[model samples]
Target: MSTNAAFRLQDAGFSRAQVEALGEFLDSQAATKTDLIEAKTELKAEIAEVKTELKAGIAAVRTELKAEIAEAKADIIKWMFGTIVAQTALIIAAVKLLH
Candidate 1:
């Protein structure tokens, strides 16, 4: 049985085959790096889109809460005014009768 040994540039001296193989390896690595960079760029764009959506959601919630708070405050004011008016009228009638 015969076995073919792999050639090393250092052991065999510089040859056209060695240089071509190195070039191919370098090209493959470059292609892989380019793919990774493109993927990272796409991810960043997606993240930006998600952040924009989140901000809009938060703003909508704040606006709704503000409206609810204003309604609650108005109801409280109306209740307070009605109570005061009724109490004052009763007190005036009682004083008038005693006199």
Candidate 2:
């Protein structure tokens, strides 16, 4: 950036301490800009890593859920067959008793 204000202050014969303070402020601003850029780059990289991990975790959970659903279906079918057999036996016993 232009140091117009600093130059004007110098031309207007400001104290040596005041001019040095302005120089220090300009140096700090430059260092701050560099630090901000580096921080932004690091944050972007970390976000990408987290996104990848989340995708992998979601895929694993989906696979586990599908397996559990299939097991539940098998259990339901087994219970249905057992129920049908029991009902048929009960009906035959009642018919024999009536006879």
Candidate 3:
């Protein structure tokens, strides 16, 4: 590929030295297989880290929701108990008045 590009550059009236220099510069700029592999490894590591953080956050939110639901259940129970007691008292009072 470099040879083809260099030949093309030479055909375009570039000097031999300029073609060689440009070829070298292009080679320097190109990413190697090793470079790509290293980048892929780093990307995988970063993705794994993000997944761990998200899992931890989800677990925390689940725990908080469970606690909130328990508190609401307790509140409902208290309200139900109070209503039952008041209803019983009124019934007793009405029965006494009738008697």
Candidate 4:
């Protein structure tokens, strides 16, 4: 049937000042932990969003590069065909003039 000061405080016989101070301290500790958790979650979400954007950007660049390469290949084929036809005509004219 005996109790201590800590027990009396638990039973609500303590002074208002002491109880309020203890409550404020507990609340501050809980708030700090909650703030840390929220900050970590927000940072992780931001990082994931940035990674997704970067991947999309890289894919777009790759697609553009592939299109450009295909266009260059077509241009080269046209140039090669034109050069061969012109050279063949020059050779035929020179042979006729010499004969």
Candidate 5:
């Protein structure tokens, strides 16, 4: 608090002891401008770090999903080829019977 302000408070029906107590209360409860700025900077840095980690995690999941999808596609293709061969062999046997 400034000298003028302190005097003003005293003139406005505040006791000197009351003004001193008010100053102490405000000092204890309020952060300085420098303290607030530093806190904001630290919070921003932590947020940026979390964002980087989250991106890495998402990319890893995407890669795993792609690999799984490729494996499933290969399994489906193998099953299809097996079914085709089986059907062709059955047709050949039926034709031989007719002959």
Candidate 6:
């Protein structure tokens, strides 16, 4: 507390001793600049750790999705080829019967 504040408190009916004790108590309970900085640093570290874990998880999921998509594409190609061959055989048999 500044001298001005102490003087104001005295004018407002607070004793010198009372004002001094109040200032001391308030200061003790308040957080310092260093305390806030330390808390901020710790929070940043925790956030970075979480971010790294998320990135690794996303990469693993991406790999799995790619594998699944490739397998699906292979199955589709096989089915398409089989359908085309079967269609061609039916068309040829129909033309011979019609003649």
Per-residue lDDT value at 75 in model 1: 100
Residue 88 shift from truth in candidate 1, angstroms? 1.3
Q: At residue 62, what lDDT does model 4 achieve?
A: 100
Tell me each candidate's TM-score.
Answer: 0.60, 0.67, 0.85, 0.63, 0.74, 0.80
TM-score winner, 4 or 5? 5
Question: How many residue pairs clash in all the candidates, one count each?
Answer: 0, 0, 0, 0, 0, 0
lDDT tens readout by residue for model 6, 1-99: 778888999999999899999889988988999999999999999999999999999999999999999999999999999999999999999999999
**Candidate 1 positional error at 71, Å:** 0.8
- Least lDDT summed over 10 consecutive residues: which range in candidate 6? 1-10
Off by over 4 Å in 6: none
Compare candidates 1 and 4 on lDDT and give the better one. 4
lDDT of 1 by residue, 51-97 (tens): 99999999999999999999999999999999999999999999999
Give the TM-score (vs. native) of candidate 1: 0.60
Best by lDDT: 6
Candidate 1 ranges with C-alpha deviation above 4 Å: 1-31
Q: How many clashing pairs in candidate 1? A: 0
Worst 10 residues of 5 by lDDT: 21-30
- Candidate 4 lDDT, 15-88, residue by residue in tens: 75776677677666675777999999999999999999999999999999999999999999999999999999
Worst lDDT run of 10 residues, candidate 4, spans 1-10
Q: How high is the CA lDDT of each candidate model? A: 0.81, 0.90, 0.94, 0.85, 0.95, 0.96
Worst 10 residues of 1 by lDDT: 1-10
Error of 4 at 82 (Å): 0.6
The stretch of ten residues in a row with the least summed lDDT in candidate 2 is 1-10
Question: Which predicted model would earn the best TM-score?
Answer: 3
Query: Pairing residues by index, what is the TM-score of model 3?
Result: 0.85
